[model samples]
Target: MDKPKVAADSPAQVELEEGKKYAYCTCGLSETQPFCDGKHMSTDFRPHVFTAEKTETCYFCRCKQTGDAPRCDGSHKKLQEPERKG
Candidate 1:
């Protein structure tokens, strides 16, 4: 069986500012995964806005092909990030 193709972002592990609107990347081409990196300029990609009601961690979708918005949706489960252990 072939493995499912996932996007390029993990879940949001950090906290967000209260009452702040964030533009998430639906397209996986963004250099800034989970966020809009202006890579969608060429395509019809649009920035997703999610207002933070309070400061808390939230998962944004990095896979431009995800049906879910502002969530990982297990798209990046197989993908690994560069080792940046401190």
Candidate 2:
């Protein structure tokens, strides 16, 4: 099993439909970004299957470091990257 890859350092804003089934990519390997495109099949990662509670714009976690799966808990804001000396 491989650790999840960071798709981005920010959350992805997406529009979700109420009662709609969605597949959120836990593995950042997906070229589809926040959504699953079956890229996790090569790894131990799997999509976070969920249904939309309400039709609204939502921020989805892309960093894959959120304690809350598929939700942006502002975890990306806490990622520590090496400071560039340039």
Tens-place lDDT per residue, model 1, 1-86, is: 12222344446555689988888766555666667778767766677878888987766655444457776567455445541111
Q: Put down candidate 2 lDDT per residue, 4-80, tens digits, no spaces.
A: 88888888899999999999999888888799999899898889999999999988988888898888998887776
CA deviation > 4 Å runs, candidate 2:
82-86
Candidate 1 global lDDT: 0.60
Q: Considering only N, C-alpha and C atoms within 3 Å, which residue pairs clash in candidate 1?
A: 26-64
Which ranges in model 1 have alpha carbons more than 4 Å from their true place? 1-9, 75-86
